[model samples]
Target: MKISIFGLGYVGCVSLACLAENGHNVTGVDVVPHKIDLINKGKATIIEKDIDEILLANWEKGNISATSNYKEAVLNTEISIICVGTPSDVNGHLNLNAIYQTAEQIGAALKEKDGFHIAIIRSTVLPGTNEKIGNIIAEHSGKKRNEGFAVVSNPEFLREGSAVKDYYNPPVTVIGTDSDFASQKISEMYEGINAPIKKTNIEIAELIKYVNNSFHALKVSFANEVGNICKKMNIDSHELMDLFCMDTQLNLSPYYLKPGFAFGGSCLPKDLKAFKTMAHDFYLESPVLNSILDSNESQKNQALNLILNKKSKKVGILGLSFKKGTDDLRYSPVVELAESLLGKGFSVSIYDRNVNISKISGTNKAYIDKHIPHLSELISDDLKKVIEDSETIIISHNVPEFKDVNLRFSNKHFIDLVKVKDIVPSANYEGICW
Candidate 1:
């Protein structure tokens, strides 16, 4: 396959060398004449382990070259990979000037060239960027995407130091775009790589990089916090962590790893309170530990604020339990927030996919029912009826029906306390955060 990669930065240089080494005719494109000269001279523009050998070998073998001509590269390739850098703006938002400019250049090249070429974005961008880029290209080229050409988002998960190995062995290969031709073309690029290929929408593809990075940052912060606390207490943090990691049952499994209702249980809530109390008693300023409760409380307040802003008497609450697939309401923040709304005189209707008012026989069930009188009366078994009769709907869980909420309750207003969708703010929509 003849492939043209735009931008000779870290991502582009490594990708060009690696793909060319695998027998693809790869051309590295960049505005920088020095980078192009470096690549054309059988040398890598950037430094990476084994990249010099790969770039030099590929260029010497006539499998790779670099040029500053976008038209020449596009005319000579079947696929164009956009690996431009999306640096952050002063306001912390992504600056897509490079990407948009590259898209325009590629579009112009596509217009001049008369072949169906697949455009793949390997840059880290925000959601909806792929579609925006696709639209820009199509409008500029005067050709329909998925018909005359294809556009896709295949985000790179390459680390800086070990990018070659990471590229060949990524955790997963996420391809965005519904076109089968686009998927096939992109998947063929990674045919030799040992990784699961995940097909999703453009937005999810864009967000996967950020989500992975943020989780890694969170893990680092959590480990540092644990180490700091252990240092103050004269305990071996590494030993404690080694022991903690050995408990693979709950520690390593998919527990407490979802974005949904506030975390509440006998153990988590009680232990958090105890930790905060211990910090206060020891006069240790443990803001990280204290912030767990503060963030949870703020989320609950956000849910309450969503309910209050409705200005309607009848508000439907979906998923009464703190989480779905469970009836344990002990320390459930949603239960407390619901009561606060009731105290303010809002008629609330509740529906839970897993919660059964009549079948709940445990002490937990009895306690929750007693605390919130008329629980069974306000609960509805039908989800559609709940949305139909209510003025405002507050989605607190990722229930099965909640996926269809956009189409189901398209007429009614929604205050989504959870980030259910990529962009939920429509005419009658209000996501917690977009």
Candidate 2:
């Protein structure tokens, strides 16, 4: 297979060498004459671990070359990977001039070429970039998308120092393209890499890199904040973090990473407030820690707004507790949401088989009594009765009994926070964040 890479920077350099090493004839393309000259001379444009050796070896085998001619590069290669820079401005908006220019150059070059071409966006870009690139190519080359050529959002997840290794050992190779032809070609290109090939929606593939990097940034900031508190208390921060990393069940695993309603339960809300307040008491300013409660409150308000915007007189809460299969209502976010709806003068009904006002005691009983004094009147054990009486139903948990309530009650509007099922947002059903 023949491939052309658009930029000669870190990502492009590593991709060129690694792909060439995998027996693909990889051409390094750039507008800068010096960068192209360096690659053509069997020298890597950027300095990194093992890149110089890999590039030199591949060049000696005649599997790689560099050129400044974008037209020739696109015409000769089957796949053109766009590795251009998407630097941000002062306002944080991406300056996609390089990406767009490369698209135009590839489109114009494809005008004189025959056969199908695949353009892989290896650059980090926002959603809808793939569509824009496809439209640009269609307009410039007088050819239709997914027919004459196709665009794939194959975002690179290569870290700077370990790029060559990262390319070979990524967690997954996500190819976001609608065309089967392009997806197959791009998958074949990465066949030797040790990762599963996940073909996904184009926009999802485009935006996942941003999501990953942003989470990475959040992790660093959170660890630093924890380290600050540990230092203040004379605790071993490194040891604490090492122990924190070992918890695969909750701490270091995918337990609460989904996009859903506000987090509640007895522990998270109470301990987070206590921890951030303790940081304040120690004369330490933890912005990340402080901002968490505000974010949680905002999510609560988001749920409230979704219910109230429906403008229904009667509202039904499918699950009253913070989560499923639990009777603990102390500081439950759903309890807070129900209280807010009642305050807004809406008729509210609560249904939770696990929650029994008779069995409730101590802090749990006290919590519910203060929030909903008339719980016995509104609460019911019968699911059908609660759902049938209400005009708007808010499903809070992902229980099997609640997942298909809309299929049974076709007239009632459902606001799902747990993504109970794949629903088409009609008058009868809607998801909170899906």
TM-score of each: 0.80, 0.98
CA lDDT, every model vs. true structure: 0.83, 0.92
Candidate with maximal TM-score: 2
Clashing pairs in 2: none
lDDT of 2: 0.92
Candidate 1 lDDT over residue span 52-91, tens digit each: 9988888989999889889899989999999988999999
Model 1 pairs in collision: none
User: Which 10-residue window of candidate 1 scores lowest in summed lDDT?
Assistant: 417-426
| lDDT tens readout by residue for model 2, 361-432 | 999999999999889899999999998889999999888787668878889999888886554455588877
Task: List the candidate 1 regions with Cα displacement exceeding 4 Å.
Answer: 276-288, 305-329, 348-434
Measured with C-alpha atoms, the lDDT of residue 16 in candidate 2 is 96
